[model samples]
Target: MEHVGVEQFPPDKTGDAMTTALLHLENHYWTESEYLAIGETPERIELFDGSLVVTPTPTVGHQYIVSRLVVSLYEVARSAGLHAFAGLGIRLGPGHIRIPDFLITTELNFDDRVNDSDVVKLICEVISPSNASTDTVQKMRHYADAGIPWYLLIDPRSETFHLFRLDGDRYTEHAKAAPGELLELTEPVVATIDPAELLPPR
Candidate 1:
């Protein structure tokens, strides 16, 4: 699984020191029920490389970008007969996971997000400067590993949105589309979009 640096909190004895039985989970596979059952502590629990990472609250700029990305993504995807969800967790590996900003599935028969099933056609991340590593590195690796056919990243700092095409277990750089450029995706679904409209004007 790809790893963005894990978020660590100040050590506290109140955590109960509950060590997980992570027996040889190196290839990044996990069940949904097992994932939610772990680490119920108030701290943000993110699954990383077979462990739980306590993440921090994202910054305001990060949130602004996320909100704008959501609106744009929803508009484009829905018009094209796709389904998308925000803040949904996906199993990437044994202990590796991701809760993409938006998850879009184009398969007509795979419309199970409101119920069950883990596979998705595409995953998107709204990137902030703080999440450079995760968006570029960690997510790129895991999304590819998970066989998610399309990956889109919205980077406010770059003033760009990236659309990746999955090739086997890795991604090929499909386009680093400028705000107004439309990216045409060829995958389990087909989507034409301009990411520039996804962000507030610069």
Candidate 2:
């Protein structure tokens, strides 16, 4: 199937390109090939089965938290010969893709823009208001279904963090921390995290 690239639809400052992309995508079942064809978009787009989940650009605060978390994770991951990345696509299945806010993986190279779920060791998502349930509920199920061993959820609004470890086919809460507490972990790379450090200073 021939898929159109983003260059075919010029974007204006008002987001006409995204609108054009969505209009063209409506009523169509997307495959990985077709989804990848629309590369380098300004918006974050994930595919579930044949559906497209379009997420608006993240706020500056969200990016700030993600950046800080990635740096912290990277220190431990690199020491253990693993790589930590932010906003990288992971292919959970044939038509399933998700871009976690941060990921730690054994795969050292990512020239293809997407990697298989098997290469992933842990997936972390910092909650955003617009997709709270999607992050806390839907993605929890999806990551478990993909056999991702560890899932970490950080909620900046709540100033909390929850870490889950896969047991059998589902994830069980392994550790969590609230404000003024520390979230420490041993497996999947050891690290101690203070939720307060993730937020911007006053």
Candidate 3:
């Protein structure tokens, strides 16, 4: 993924100084140490080589789905002696990192800046209109390359959910649920998910 420019701000506003600094930082090559040094930020930032992929703050609707999934997955994960996390940074390579909306892992080590990809058992991404391809295409390829066992994609717009299992360097659709249906899974952990419960009360 390439670095799309930073969020723009008006020249006459108080944000001008911060905007100028961010623009200047963009020109420099980013290293893992430098990226880690910046620490937690308001916006979700992923590192790809020397570039940064900045995702804007998620909408309330987007977060609602994530929260619902996390709660549901956490129960299953606990039973299997695993852990579930949301917005956790995962290190794919030396200077490559990606943060899935939600994830299930074998362990939780907060000492590390980001968890290693190998520890991640499953990942979930709730699709947003602005970055649908980033979640569906780019992330799918990268996560599979990293050997993540399972991936779950939830698209609120389409009211659907897709479950995939890594199949030798690629992902093969394992199962899916359409609007108002239940998605059942048996591998990596056994659990059933309802697409309707992911949305806000109507």
TM agreement with the true structure for every prediction: 0.66, 0.87, 0.87
Each model's C-alpha lDDT? 0.63, 0.83, 0.83
Answer with 1 or 2, whichever has the higher TM-score.
2
Q: Model 3, stretches more than 4 Å misplaced?
A: 1-24
lDDT tens digits, residues 63-114, model 3?
A: 9999988898888899999998999999987899988999999977889869
Clashes of each: 6, 0, 0
| Model 2: lDDT of residue 146 | 96
Estimate, for each residue in 31-82, the C-alpha lDDT of model 2 and write its tens digit: 7877876767787888887777778899898998899988888889989888
> Whose lDDT is higher: candidate 1's or candidate 3's?
3
- Residues 1-202, candidate 1, lDDT per residue (tens digit)? 3222222355458863342434344454444444564544443455664544445566666666667656656766677677666666565666565667777765434332222224588788877565679788977887777777878887777777787888888998787777557777665455565666556655
Report the lDDT of model 2 for residue 46.
85
